[model samples]
Structures are given as C-alpha cells and as structure tokens.
Target chain A: MSELGFLFAGYAVVWVALGGYIIAVGRRQSTLRREIARLEREFRTGE
Target chain B: MTTVSPGSTAQPDATAAVADGGAGGGVTTAAAAPLPEPGRTLWLDILGVVAILSVLVALYGAIIWAPTEAVMGHVQRIFYFHMPSAWVALGPAFTIVFICSIVYLVKKDLRYDRIAGASAELGVLFTTITLLTGPLWAKPIWGAYWTWDPRLTTTLVLWFIYVAYLMLRSSITEGHSRARLSAVFGIVGWIDVPIVFMSIRWWRTIHPTLVTGEGMNLDSSMEAVLMLSLAAITLLYVYLLIVRVRQLDMGSRLDRLRQLSHLR
Candidate 1:
C-alpha cells in the first residue's frame, strides 16, 4: 500500500482503540451504578 | 457546570449484577448512601469538550498545517499521531501507574489502585496504537512490517508487561489481593519505560531519535504539529483517566457495601 494508505490506516487504528476503551468503561460504569442503587434500596427497606 | 444530576444516583438495570441474591434481601443502615452516577461528572464534561476541540485542532495541524517531509514524503506525516501515542504511553500513562502503584503500596488505599489500573489500561491502549502505526510506517519505508530492533523490542515488552498487569487486575477475585499484587507488578512493569526510551540511543536501531534537543533537528512546523498532537493526546488521556478512576471508585464502594450487607 502507499504511504498515505498507511497513514490513514494508522489513524483508523488509533480511533478504534481509543473509542473502544471509552465504550467499555462506560458499559462497566453503568452496570456498577445499577448494582449500587439496587443494594442501597434493599438496605433501606430492611433497616 | 454542575456535573451531578442532583437526584438519586444509579439506575435500575445494574441491580442484577450486585443483587444480594443470597441475602435476606433487605435494606441496611450501611447501604443508605446513594451511589454516585458515573456519567454525570462535570469535570468529564469540561475535559471531554476541551479534549475533543484539541484533537480537532491537532488533526488539522498534523495533516494540513505541517509541511510534507522531503525525504519520506507523506508517510512521515504519520509521525504526528505516531510519536504522541508513544509519548503518552511512556510518559504520563505509565508514570501515573508507577506513582499510584507506589502510593497504593504505602497507603494501602484502593483509590490509588483504581488510578493505576485505569492508567495502565489507557497506557496499553496508546501503546497498541504506537505498535500498530510503527509497522505501517515501516512497511513502505523499511520494506518490512516487523523488526526486532532494540527500541521496538523493548516497547513490545513494555506493552506485554502492562497487559499482564491488566489481566492480573481482572483475574483476581479479591480486591485487596488484586490491588497488592498488581501494585508490585505495576512498579516492576514501569521499569521498562526508560529502557524503551533509551534503546535507540543505546543500540544501533532504525527508530528515530527523540524529536527535540540532543542534536536532533525537526522542522518548525513539524515540531509545532507534534506538540499540538501531544497536547491533544494528553488531554484525552486525562479525560479518560477521570472517567475510569471515578468508575473504579464507585465499583470499589459498591463492593464495600456488598460486604457490609453480607455481614448483617
């Protein structure tokens, strides 16, 4: 492939890696928050 | 801007993951505090906005503002993104891991562990970019996609060491043991960074020298774009770190609450 081809490819790899990391973190955060809320409500009523 | 939603924290969906399914299923006094919403951080909004803008400006500077290189033609343009990814990986990312690892070891605080883990993950992400882009630039210029040059080899090793760090964090079920063990490895893993930096100077290698000082020469425009790109990447790293660290903090707290509820 041409040099420009390589250049564009590199940018694509960068964006994909960074974007994926962000999305993964977001997913984990949402799951954790949901658990936290559920546990808190259960504790409130039990008390 | 206010970062919080000012209402009850968390959502209904995450309930399944941390449900005290085994517990008698009742709210306790310890669990009354609301969990902070991870997405609502004001700092994230501010930093995210700034990072996006900087990346846009850096993108323009890298492709349009910087003049093309005479020797390598357009391929050298990849240097703008390429070098900064390596820079962030070797510099702030690992440094944060190293610093936080030490602090975690000394203080035994889970917060530092969270920061170290987050930074290590981000470090690996950027290093993957570096590793990927290096080969792309090399293929057209060096006639091969892979080389066992000193710098490249050390960088690859550096990447693996931190990859192991992440694996350790995820695989260990207990939080304290995970933090303790990973802290040790995190410190050890960071030892390779300086070696990676000095490899080109220490051995006969194909990798370019550091872009500034020490008898190296870079065009004014090239240097400017590189700096801008580095700044943009740094901002992005900070934003990511903020998001990741906050999430980890919340996760750790939830784990504590789980333990507390289990005790009743």
Candidate 2:
C-alpha cells in the first residue's frame, strides 16, 4: 500500500472506533434514564 | 409559641410579626429556586459545533496539507493528533483533581463530587485514546508497540491510578462518605501527573520530548497545523465535559424530583 493509503486507513479505523464508543455511551445514558424513570414510577405507586 | 433556648425570642403575635417584618424590612422572600439560563446552553451548543468543525479542518490539514516526514513517512501524520490527544487528556485529569479539591475544602458539596466523577470518566476516555494512539503510531516508528521506558511506564501507572479512582467510587455506597473518600483519592492520584511528566524529562528516554523549554522546532507549516489541531482537540474536550456534566445534572435532578413526588 502507498503511504497515503496506510495513513488514511489508520484514520478511518480510529474514527470508526470513536463513533462506536459514542454510540455505546449514548445507549448507556438512555438505559440509566429509563431505569430511574421506572424506579420513580414504582415508588409513587407503592406510596 | 414557646421560646425554649436562652437566646431565642418569640413574636408576641405571629400574624403581626409577619405583616410588620415584611412591610418594614421590604424583604420578599421566595423559595431557593434556580433560574434557567437558555443563552448559556445555546452558546455551549455553538461552541460544540465550532470545535467539531475545527477538528475536521485540522485533521485535513494534518493528513493532506503537511508534508510527510522523510523518516517515518505517512505514519508521522498521526503525531499531530497524538500529541494533541495527550494534551487534551491532561486537561480533564487536572480538572478532576482541581474540582475535587475545591469540593472537599469549600462547602464539601456532593454536587462538585459528581462533577469530579464526570470529569474523571471523560478523562479516562481521552487518556485511553492517547494510550492507544501512541502505540499505533509507535509501532511504525519505534519498532515495538509497547515499551517499558519511563514515559510509557509512568503514563501506564497514571492510567491505572485513575482507573482505581473509578473503582474506588463504585465500591462505596453513594453518599457524603463516598464523596469525601473519593475526593481524597482523586487528589492523591493527581500527584502522579507531574511525576509522569518529570520522569520522562529528568531521565533519558527514547520518547522525543518535543515541547520542553528547549523549544519545539518545526517547519512553519508543521507548527501551524500542530497548534490548530491542539486548539481543536482542547475545544472538543470542553464540549464533551459540558455535555457529560449536563447529563449528570439531569440525572440528579430527576432523582430528586422522584423522591419529592414519592413523599407527596
């Protein structure tokens, strides 16, 4: 592979990994929010 | 009402006291409510967009505009972003330590503790990127992806210390005790930062010390691109910090609202 090709490929891989991480963090945030909401509902109903 | 304490005094009549105190004192007391600031959020969003754009432009400049190094060839391109990532990591790590210290010394507020937690989380993210990218770049230049040199070893230790900080946080139940304990750990962990930086400098190492007091000598174009990339990544760190802090704040507010509603 040409030098430029190798460089571009490395950049692409790093960015792809970064994108995946962002998505994972977003998912975790959503799940945490849902869990809290569910707990709130339960506390209210029990009371 | 009865005044039980020695220094305490009771109003002759509660109703009269309220009427007289308010009219005479001109003090309109209300609940301690926080006001919403829309402009700040808008500015943060704008800054986030600008930071993202700057990073993109800087990346283009690094990859395409700057001439490839004769020795390392294309792999040298990674050094621009790599150094910037390391710089960005320092930002959040220092932020975590500084805020944790303030929180511990001042009001001992858990809000700042939470902020420290968020900062530490983001710090880990950036530090991990630095660690990973360094290896990827080094594998081509240094002939080995891993090294036991002072710079690499100290950084690894620094990474583990912060990771331990997070583990310490999780091990404790969430409360004032947890906050205080974590604050102490955070402060202690930060002492390693200077040690890590100094070890590489004080002793000889294979890692190139590019930006020490001796000065960073580079082509004008190379210097410009490096500065731009550093600025872009620093802005990105700020943007990420704001977002993460907001998310934590929202989560806390939702928790409090739920508790209050449960009481009702």
Candidate 3:
C-alpha cells in the first residue's frame, strides 16, 4: 500500500474508535434515563 | 419518630425514603446527597470546540506542512497524534488515581468518589483509543500490529486494571463499601502507569521513545502539530469528564427524587 493509503487507513481506524465510544456513551445515557423514569414511576405510585 | 430499620434510618430524609422504597423493594439507602444544581459551564464546551479545531489544524499540518522523515517517510505523520493520545490517556488515569487518593483520605463526602468514577470511565475510553490507534500507527511503521514490548504490555495491564475498577464499582450495590474498595484499587492500579513508562525507557523496545529527546527527532512544523494535537485532546478529555460527572450527578438526584416521591 502507498504511504498515503496507510495514513488514511490509520485515520479511519481512529475515527471508528471515536465513533464507537460516542455511541457507547449515548447508550449509557439512555439506560440511565430509563432507570430514572422507572424510579419516578414507582415513587409516584407509592405516594 | 417511628422506629426505623437500620437501612431506612440512614436515608437522607422523608422524601428520599419514599423514593427509595418506591424504586425497589429492598434497595439500601445511599449516602449520596441531593445533587447540586449544575451551573452553566461553557469553558469545557468552548475548550472542546477549540481542541477539535486544533486537531484539524494539526492533522493538516502533519500531512501537508511537515517534511517527510528520511527513514519512515509518510508513516511518520501518525506519530504526531499517536504519542499525544498516549499522553492524553495518562492524564485521565492520573486524575482518577489522584481523586481516589483524596476520597480515601477525606471520607467526608461522596463527591470525590463520583469524581474518581468519572475520571476512571474517561480514562478507560482514552486508553482504549490509544491502544487501538497505536496499533494502526504501528502496523505501517513497526511492520506488525501487535507487540509484547514492555510499553505495550504494561499499557494493556493498566487498561485492564481500570476496566476491572469499573467492573468492581458496578458489581457491588452502590454505597460506601463499593467506593472504599474501589478507591484502594484505583490508587494501587495507578502505580503501574509510572512503571509502564519507566520500563519502556529502561529496557530496549520497538515502541518509539520520542519523549526522551532521543533518536526520533521531529521537525519544527511536526513539533507544532504534535503540541497542538496534545492540547486539543486534553481539552476533549476535560469536556468528556465534565459531561460524565454531570450524568452521574443527575442519576443520583433522580434516585433521591424517586425515593422522596414514594414517601409522600
């Protein structure tokens, strides 16, 4: 592979890793939100 | 006051008790206080944006501005961001270790524990990025993707240790016990970071030792790009840390609110 090809390949890998992490963060945020909503529902019902 | 169970007595207040009971049948009370209101923190956001721009400039500079090395040729460009990322990963890991130490020493509040957790999570993310990118950079330069060199081996160990730290925090039901034990592990694991650096330096290995002012010499433009990328990644780290901390704080508050609502 040409040098430029290798460089671009490296950049692509970096971006993929970054994108994967951002997605994971988003998933965690959603899960936390769901838990919060569940708690809120239970609290309201108990009261 | 009515005679409360050991678990119920430790709850924050009536509101928190109701929320706790409502949320789960047998959830224990936590010592976490109601989260303070988060003020507008534009500094992190601004820094993140600036860092992104700086990284862009660095990328362009590395590829277009700097002259190619006599030996490594085009592949040498990867070193600019790769080394900075390795440095950036250390920043969060060190922060996690420092905060964990403070939390253990003070023991007055749970904020320190939360900070330590946030930093650990961020550290893991950055470390993973470093590990992944390093190999991509290495494949072309080092002629192989994986190396059992001292630096690489120690880095993998450091990454796993933090991964275990997160696992430890999640496995236990949230409370003082989890925080205390994790705090100990966090500090202990951090000892390996310095060992990793030292081992890489003292022993001969393929891992580039640019920081030692050694064989690998960067041109002026390459140096500028590297410094800029480092600054940008550091800003990005700070931004992520703040965002993660806010999320944790919100989750804690939501728990408390749910408990309080149940009490009412």
Q: Highest lDDT among the candidates is held by which one?
A: 1
* Model 3 misplacement above 4 A: A30-47, B1-41, B196-213
- Alpha-carbon deviation at B134 in model 2, angstroms: 1.1
Candidate 1 lDDT by residue in tens digits, B1-264:
224422224444444433655244543544546556645767679889999899999999988888887767787777788889988998899999999999999999888988998999899999999999888877886787877766677778889889999998999966678889999988887876676657645775455632222232469988989899999999999988888888888776776566555445
DockQ of 1: 0.58
User: Quick one: ranking by DockQ, best first?
Assistant: 1, 3, 2
lDDT of 3 by residue, B74-169 (tens): 877777766776777776556665676566657746667777888887777777777776676667766777776666766788789889988999
> For model 2 chain B, where is the 10-residue window of minimal lDDT?
B1-10
Per-residue lDDT of model 3, residues A1-47, tens digit only = 77777778767766677668668766877877666655645644554
- Pairs clashing in candidate 3? B15-B260, B18-B259, B18-B262, B18-B263, B19-B258, B19-B259, B19-B260, B20-B259
Candidate-wise lDDT, in order: 0.79, 0.67, 0.68
TM-score of the second chain, each candidate in turn, equals 0.78, 0.76, 0.75
Q: Please name the candidate that would achieve the greatest TM-score relative to the true structure.
A: 1
DockQ of every predicted complex = 0.58, 0.13, 0.39
| Chain B, candidate 1: TM-score | 0.78
Model 2, first chain, TM-score of 0.78
